[model samples]
Target: MKIGLLPLGRPTFDVPFAEEKLAAMLAALDATGHEIVGPRELLFDEAATRAAMAGLARAGIDQLLILQVTFTDASMAVAAAAGFDQPLSIWAVPEPRLGGRLRLNAFCGLNLASHALGLNGRAFSWLYADPGDDIAGDLKALLAGERPAGRLDAVPVATRSPDGARVAEALRGQKIARIGEHPVGFDTCAYTPEAVQALAGVSVDALALDDLFDTARTVPAEAAAEVRRAAEADVTGLDAVNQEELDRSLRLKAALETIRESGSYNAFAIRCWPETFTQYGGAVCGPTAMLGEGQVPCACEADVYGALTQLVLLEAAQAPVFLTDLVDMDAADNTGVVWHCGQAPISMRDDTAEATATVHTNRKQPLLYQFPLKPGPVTFLRISQAFGAPKMILSFGEMLRRPMAFTGTSGVVRFERPAGAVLADIIACGLEHHMALAYGDHRATLRAVAAELGLPLLEI
Candidate 1:
């Protein structure tokens, strides 16, 4: 990627020193294979800044990294660049002094520049570093267009759409496991294993439920006790079939451990299928949910690609994450319903389950859930393809605080466009309707991966 570094204004101190710092920053960036535009001054005067921006735009640069805002008065130049709507990153550096009384007030100027850029409603990233730390990675990652900060930087975006078709195609060579068979004859959750292999280049392996059972049988008594305690605290009716459910759930965890121990799979999808429903006569949501949270990608749809997508996302971020279906949607208030067999990992919960989660064990049957979800802020996202394009839907807000309360929380999301319009833009390009929902904002890194894999992106 070619990055245009336009010096917004003249230096407040020595011009040569300013040039030297800019050169150092560029040199660091150059190592990463990104072409830097220059020490070119966009504005010696405010008016000149506007002219420089036009020139940069005409030159067709991918992004801009604004430098030395206090120097060379170019407020107009920054404003003009912002007008173009190119991705921007505002760099603020602390003055160099060997721990000598901390002289220059770098923050004051950076704050002013950030505010000016903010007025235009532009999204940008900020970094504070001296000559030492590796800032080029940050710059390239941003120029490539991913969130450059926080845990979200690691979340992966998988595409089965045209935008990411090549990526999905490349992914085909990879191997993954989907534990247990699809619920006997439940078709809704059925998947075409042949279609998955043909389309995604993935080799699928079906695991035995006995593996999970064996692991559960051998679990340390303490672990089983913890499971029971968690269940007792969170689920209702301990006497109403608590032991039965706990035994099954613990066994499921043990099975997951066995799968992990084998090391034959890069990722996994398990059927907490409905037989556990008829036989145990309770639910298996907690165990399956826990498996996903533990880092295995468990898909309720018995979808190989879906599990792979979740696995990719999980690899990007090491934090606890949930894999769920968009079970309900309310356009009236912009609220949606999301539920599954409740087998998501317990780590994904910031708090305890509000109520018990249940499901029939059929892998092909719709998961039945009755628990109120844990509460906290959440960022919802989906990565799927349409007409061959890879697209995403990312939004953030607090999960409903009250227990399974008020039919779930809903609100209007603020963005450059509406969800339908965004969806339209994505589908018009031919992306997939399937998406992997994550619980955090991962726009930046996901975008970067999309670009690397040659997929078009939508940022709503």
Candidate 2:
């Protein structure tokens, strides 16, 4: 098979050692006699990484190797990886502490890369071997389909107490408000309220963004001030945000709260997009997070089904559920990240990582929470209609300890199944990119929900 290589390097490292690692990796690839691809020099920045990835793809490589020469940026590899369809892998060299400042954080770099790639719904291979060694052999083993054993522990399992009828009885009169239309082309958001009602006994109250925005404008100044005060009290990086941006975000919170109150809605799924940024003066992630933590269950991007899923998971686990994109995964560790653009509750923030108020990554607008999620047992579930049928995908895993791989709320979860296999099921089943994430393993409850509703379940 023709193989591609991207030797990633960071600017902070002494260029020589990184260069040596690159040269050594290239030599190893040369030994394999596969059609090796990519620039002869290593990639150090976004532009170079993009160019190398495109160049290798143009050369028609069957597999791609992301060689972490020395603790490189996750964005460089992940951004490039986003466009590639070939099997992916990361090879990192270990850095030993020898009574000096660490020369390389290559392993940590790999860990972060895995988080970003896995959360994007991409599965990748990895090896922790230095260059000029048996990396080629390891690469060939991965290419030939060998997986190391890794499993999550203490995955919480709930006793199946209530049957479908009982659970549906509890949901019979519950109503959730969904504001505005789903994001464009997100057909996963297409749901008949009757379908939800028939299966789960919940109702969707469709509302308009205009109504919410209008209500927000009329909210008393004191109310908006209270929202701002509450938001600022626990967050650590409020000082970094501009005052106008901060107030704009608070106003969004006020508007949504007012709409929720007027309708007497139990939960909301909001269109937190172009309108929030273009029409309003800020992003709605912070406000959405606050609402979700408050048990209102606001689904970003106006996904009504996702919002409902959050409510269900909340009922099962009684914890806040985050709607995240499964961006990146690592085969070696059987782990990946559930990441989104800053909407996870502050309560989920890892104690070690400061809970900072930050802007959205792409739009560079204010009001998204930025922190690594605290680690423990976790569950991921997505409710979707695929192949003309409604199904709920459920999985249990351990929220492993790791630094947040990217901006926003991210949890590093190591799954019981092979990360690649889970990704394969996602594609085979045509699952949506959005997942409802809640703490603890509620697999048993989720299974009961699926069984009671006669919906299929993909246990990945």
Candidate 3:
């Protein structure tokens, strides 16, 4: 079979690592004896992607294979599906858990592509493996147009929770202040206002990223100092990072407080990324963690549904909730790693380790929370649009005490079921990458909430 390969990536991640992985992946594909066509270089932007796609179309390959070299938005993946008539396949390589920065977060790119393609009603096969792994059989299966099937555990029968009605009522008339649009190609963060309002009675207030920046600049020096003092008490090593950036990061907390009070917001969905570092001269991870610890949930990447999921879990658990990404899963160990760039609440920090102030691994910006999550029973929830409809996703797990798997806030979780099974279900269902996690068992309350909302409960 002839394969047209398009390698995708972003500059925000480790480019050298991605390039190395790309070389090995290319070698693996070449060893498959399939005729390969298209550029060997990574496509970092739309113009390059479009040029490559056009060349591949003219090549008339038997299949279009997207080499997910790093974590990127799903825009180009969807574009490829829309433009090509050939069978589509995605292959993402895994990086080692070195207790450092996450290099080549290719699986997340695959996850985003899967959700976007599924949402667009496109059929595609996928593979997750290291470049040197024995995946010749998987490659053959992909060429044969085989897709992985996902399993759905039977929905738990709803039991009455005394606080279910109160929680439901509280959810109504609540507003989420969404600051800035979700990043380009992040369909996982996309939301329909009508769908959101109809399901949760929650209204969304969209605010500009500039608004937060401007407000942060005008924060009174005394107020920013007060925030700094509060942060210094709980988080250690603040003085080690860039002082100017740390001050700016603390001011962001005050700005968020001002916005929350003025808007009467119950939660925030913020686009915490390039602009925060490039344009605003600060990172929001630390401030987001602070708000979450204070019982105000903040979802990174402007994920409105993620914020809503956090609110539901917070109400159900009566504790802080963290929005995290499922970055790694190992069936052999029966565990998976959940992580984000460092916005986990301090309240969730493992007592064995002090929560430390840090910088973004890639951006080198100050004010990120660095610590592993506390070990205990944890419940994961997501308000999902996977498979083209809104549903309630619930999963049970135990947070294991372990060394930091990667930079930022992360934890190794052993699921109630096999880790491999959970991974299969997630990919098969095309579930969103983001899940709201709260320590303790709130499955019963979540079931009642799902029942009240008339949503299909999918437990993986």
Best by TM-score: 3
lDDT per residue as tens, model 2, 1-460: 8888788886666577777777877787787667777787867777788888778878888888778877654676666677788778777775432222335557556655654454455666667666655566776675554632122111222334475336545666788888888754345566788888887778888888888777767778899889878887757777788877777788888888777777777788888877887787688899888988887788876777787788778777777878877655666667776777788988888888788788875456888888888988888887766544677778778887786666677777888788867654554454656788888877777777666666667666
Instruction: Choose 1 or 2, whichever is better by TM-score.
Output: 2
TM-score of each: 0.47, 0.67, 0.97
Instruction: List residue ranges in candidate 1 displaced over 4 A.
Output: 1-175, 181-203, 209-242, 264-266, 279-282, 344-377, 381-435, 458-460
Could you give candidate 1's per-residue lDDT for residues 1-460 as a string of tens digits? Answer: 6676766544334455555665666566667787677445424555565566667787787777766533222254346545666667655454432211112233333433443333333456555445456566665565676633211111344543342333444464666677677543222233556755654456788767556555666777777777666555544554544455556665555556557667556566655544455443334456555556556666653555567666545544445556554322322334433434345455444354444433232232222234445555555544443222234444444445333421211112222344334322322222222345455555455454455544444554
Q: Please count the clashing residue pairs in each candidate, in the order shown.
A: 52, 16, 0
Residue 276 alpha-carbon offset, candidate 1, angstroms: 2.9
Candidate 2 — which residues are off by over 4 angstroms?
A: 1-160, 163-166
User: What's the TM for model 3?
Assistant: 0.97
Residue pairs with colliding backbones in model 3 are none
C-alpha displacement of 325 in model 3, angstroms? 0.7
Residue 13 miss distance in model 2 (angstroms): 25
Per-candidate Cα lDDT values, in order, are 0.48, 0.72, 0.89
- In model 1, how large is the Cα lDDT of residue 118? 35
Q: Write the per-residue lDDT of candidate 3 for residues 233-344, one digit (tens) a residue.
A: 7789999999999999999999999999999999999999889999998999999998999999999899999999998888889999999999988777899999998889
When summed lDDT is taken over every stretch of 10 residues in candidate 2, the lowest stretch is: 148-157
